[model samples]
Target: MTDSGQFNSELMAFLDASPTPFHAVQSMQQRLQQAGFVRLDESQPWQLQPAGRYFTTRNGSSLIAFVRGTAALPEGGLRLIGAHTDSPCLMIKPHADLYAHGYHQLSVEVYGGALLNPWFDRDLSIAGRIVVSADGQLRSRLIDFKRPMAVIPSLAIHLDREANSDRTINPQNDIKPILLQGGDSSLQAIIAEQFMAADEQLVDYELSLYDCAGATLSGADSQFISSARLDNLLSCFVGLQSLLASDASHTAVLVCNDHEEVGSVSAVGADGPFLQAVLGRICGDQLDSALATSLLLSCDNAHALHPNFPAVHDAAHLPQLNGGPVIKTNVKQRYASNALGAALVKQLAGRCGVPLQSFVARNDMGCGSTIGPISAAKLGVNTLDIGIPQLAMHSARELTGASDPLRLVTLLTAFINSVAPLCVIAD
Candidate 1:
């Protein structure tokens, strides 16, 4: 296959492999480790040196990996790129058991800004964290109940005459997915048996409901990708591939955190101390300067204006498919990009002859945010938010530029390979 075809295959494989946030982090860890990156455990002391590759994970959902620069700790700082693993879905709630009209269902709370209507009548499955009893020991595992499992079917328009004109979902009542058709199909029992923890109590869970439908490449020429959870996972895959492929003298870092859709406040989220802790351990005492000159590219999917909804977007700055990576900005600071970060990316894109675009949400319309500001503040580093323009963000299936991921990987490779001097004294 050609390079583009190869990339498409790889991307589809990635999406298929990463069904949940936990799975995403695991896939990244495996890739980096295969590329010769040593795993670093924070519980143990870090003895970082130049020319080494190291990484660490948090709560099995967030990850931070960095390549040590050949030069000494730079007074400037590290080059960091960030993205998120989590997406909008329905999460199973604690005390999740429920039965209605002899139908078994799981209580669920909506996570993030989910387009609830699209989720209805879809082949939904359960995925995320689960604790098991293994040989009398409790262990946590991520599982995808990978089947045509549950669904929250919408009421027929004929039954609810005004369904099209006025319909709102009630997370507690209307959105509970129909899991089974019998007297307690023993959903919990099945989970316990699979986990080998039938004897143990179901202490807790953070499972999310996901569409089991596979992502596909459509169009006569296969120019379009349609799938769930593409809003940010596409960026995660691009960043991971770029970071692993990079052979730069300077350090290249990729951070994938969970909970980005729902305020990002979890322990494994960008708002948490995951990135900072990893960086601090890696840089040791020289972390001061290592953070000063550091820059981050917050990679997430940006909104592409839809022809049908042209009025919602800015008339002057319309982003098209395959246009290239977008440099996102918000006057209200929803995005963390500043003059310096924008200039640097643009200059680098120019130097590499790669096309670049810009995105600014209409002033009247509110904006969505990424992990950029959170990381910048946590590490005191400069950051820019960037992405490939996409349509159907947060929908059951999203669309993006066919060649955008490759373009982004190219620009990121350039950034990682570019050199900056570092001055330091070994402690």
Candidate 2:
């Protein structure tokens, strides 16, 4: 077992380094390479062997890492864990430069279902992938300013007496971050300067603004973690750690897809063919038989019961922070957890001695969804939705119990190494 403090310390480092999905995938790739996992290119032919560990990526944003076990594919099947790499934030637009009233700003569009209010009055930085033309060829590069470069200052109360009561943000005009009071540099020039490539021509880019603050332990007793993108990054880190600690006796796969926050419709998203294509190549002729015995655990942060908003949660199904991992369920299939899937997780948690909790939205309120339903539908695999409890899910900064992350990792590692049958026959 890993120390909770050590695990959290590393997780904080990961969060700080990964300001965007491209960065997150890059960070995970480094760790996977260090662990002796060979990288596979999708465009090339794969010569996979049993008991080999390998990883692959799509669009430099999503990643899939797997360990082929010594066991047969049709018998043990794949123990797959899924999470999303993308989060809600402000994305930089194509023509981002905006100069108004002697102030240079960058126009940004809201990405995903972000809580716009929290974005105001925050020190932000930009980081993402940029395509540049150099030496008569196009190349992609990842860049992070790694410092406070801009801010979205809120208007004072004097400007509007109802600023706090009836304030509404106009994504188009209100959220443009001020870059400098008076600057002659364009967005392209700034990016080129960062790369020290004055001769390179900027072709296209995908950039996003992120909070300058790093992840840290908070609360009176330091029981909570506060950071940006915890909605799904927390799950991504947990899944990665669990895969690293597995015994490798059974086939285990960890897939962190991009664009789940925006309905996952992209080519590299869970709704696409990324995972399916990889699985088909791995299972070959035994794909159908393997899927029949396979199980997927879709890990995403669950809404914790907020003290101030206790009435918003279902009375009996309220999940608490620091309690344990949550098994999310929705009768409408918003979540993919069924009785059989939930029972398997319960069994695994019980064997690992990890506490478990349940979460279901109040009858009147609508529930949020995760990659569970999407992956389950796409792969025809039994899937369960589970995660650590968190608060202020879509805010610029989110919170989760510091202890729950380690507990969730412990339970998932057990699932990955388990020799028990993954399937249960229904009467």
Candidate 3:
């Protein structure tokens, strides 16, 4: 039996090891590989076997792992947990190298709705995919500037007397991260040097700035996790662990898509055909029927009730840190937790002996949406929005209860492993 402390320890390591989506997928792939799961490629034929464990990756950022079951196809459907590998960060542009006042800075674009204030003066690094030509063939390589290579400094208070009073960030002008002091070195040169590929040429890249400060267990009693990318990476890791532990009666799938933070519309995102294509191959002619009966657990991070701003949350639907997993809801379908889905989760929680929590935004406040509704509408699968409660969701470093992840793992393992159907016919 794995204790909560051990789980948190692993989660912290996962967070520290994964600085970008590319790195995140690599980390998950390594874990699944160690757990006796084989890797499959999309270009090659998949000879799936019953009771077999296999996984696959796309664009090196998105990943899907599944376990074949003993039950019949289509009718048995699938138990899937979907999460995103993306978080709010600054992405380096193509012409990123800029020289200003003898200090070289990297021009970046805001990738998502990042809480920009927290990004200033933080220890930052760069990591993403780089394209290089080798032997007249195009190849992709993942790079990580793991050390404190950059920092987005704030304007001095003396320069702006009202800096603290009305601070508004201009992404174009105010957020250029100073990387080094030089005019001769290009961005490609820096990357090529890191690659140790003096013979290779750097053509293009998709790099993002990241917090190099590692994840830590905070609080006096070490009861909290403080880290970056926790919004979705936490769920990604939890789903991976649960799927690896499950001997699911029906087919179990875990899809961690990229670009969810930026609306999930890319070739490797959840909105694209990556998942549908995989389902088609797995279900054969029964793809439609299998999807109709399939259940999707859209696992993302849920907002926890802030101690300082309790009024921001719905009074009756406040979720607390360390309470347990939260089933997020919205009447506007921002989250796809319908009556059936909510009941199913509650039932699973009961069986797993995990306390269930619910989260609903204040009526006047605009609610944040997840990948749940998009998945349900696109695939026609029954989807439920669920996650661990955490504070400072889109910040550079977020906070969460240490034990919440273990609770989610327990529920999801039982949920996926259960042999019974997700719904009753009401005979």
Candidate 4:
């Protein structure tokens, strides 16, 4: 078992290093390589061996890492854990250059369901993938400004008296971040300078503004973690740690998809063919048999009961900070948790001696979904939705109990190592 303090320190470093999905995948790939997992190229033929550790990525964003167990895959099946890498943020527009009133700014589009108010007046930086035409060939590279380069200042109260109560943000008119005062710098020039590509031509790019501040242990007793992209990144870290710690007796897979904050319909997203393609290659002729005994745990942060907004949550289903992992369920099938799947998690939690909680939105409020249902439908596997309870989800900065992530890691590690059959027989 990992020490709580050590686990959180490593997690904070990961959050600080990964500002976008590309960076997150890169960071995870490096860690996997260090742990002896061989990287596989999608275009090349694979020669998998029993007990071999391997991983592959799609679009430099989504990733799938697995360990082929000594046991037959069709008999023991796969222990799968799923999470996403993308988060809600302000994405740079193609025509990003804007100048008004002697101020240079960049036009940005709101990506996903972001809490706009918190984004105001925050020190922000840019990081993402950029395509460059260098040496007479096109190449894709990741870049990060690595410093506070811009800010979105809020309108003064004198300008909008109702700013506190009924203020509305126009994505087009209000959110352009100020880059400099009376500067002649173009976005392309800035990118070239950052990349040191003096002779290369900037072809295209995908960039997003992120909070310059890094993750930290917060609260008086340092009981909570405050950071950006904790919604799913936290799950990704936990899944990776659990996979790394597995005993390798059973097949274990960790998949981190991209674009979940949006509708997850992209080529590298959960709704796409990424995971299916990987599974088909791994299982081959026994794909159906393997899926019948496999289980997927979709881990995404759940909304914790907020003390200041208690009325917004169902009284009976109020998940608490540091209370343990939460099993999310919805009758409408927004989440993929069924009775059998939920029961399996419960049994696992009990065996691991980890506390557990349940969450259901207020009767009048609609519930959100995760990759659980999508993966289950795509592969015909039993899946459950679970996550650590969190506060201010989709905000520029989010919060979760410092201990909950470690608790989840413990449970998932057990699940990956367990040799028992993962299915329940229905009478």
lDDT of each: 0.80, 0.93, 0.89, 0.93
Error of 2 at 293 (Å): 0.7
- How does residue 25 of candidate 4 score in lDDT? 98
Off by over 4 Å in 1: 134-136, 195-201, 420-427
**Candidate 3 clashing pairs?**
none
On the 0 to 100 scale, the lDDT of residue 394 in model 4 is 94
Better of 3 and 4 by TM-score: 4
Supply candidate 1's per-residue lDDT for 171: 67
Sorted on TM-score, best first, the list reads: 4, 2, 3, 1
lDDT, candidate 4, residue 363?
Answer: 85
lDDT of 1 by residue, 21-49 (tens): 88888888888888899998888988877
What's the residue-level lDDT of 325 in candidate 1? 91
Model 4: how far residue 121 lies from native, Å: 0.6
Every candidate's CA RMSD: 3.4, 0.9, 1.4, 0.8
Off by over 4 Å in 2: none
lDDT of 2 by residue, 1-427 (tens): 5799999999999999999999999999999999889999999999988778899999999999999888998899899999999999999999999999999999999999999999988899999999999899999999999999999998888988998789888899899999989877799888888874777999999999999999999999999999999988889999999998877788899999999999999899999999999998888999999999989999999999999989999899989999999999999999999999899889999988899999998889998999999999998999999999999999999999999999999999999999998988777
Give the Cα-based TM-score of candidate 2 against the true structure. 0.99
| Model 3 spans with C-alpha error above 4 angstroms | none
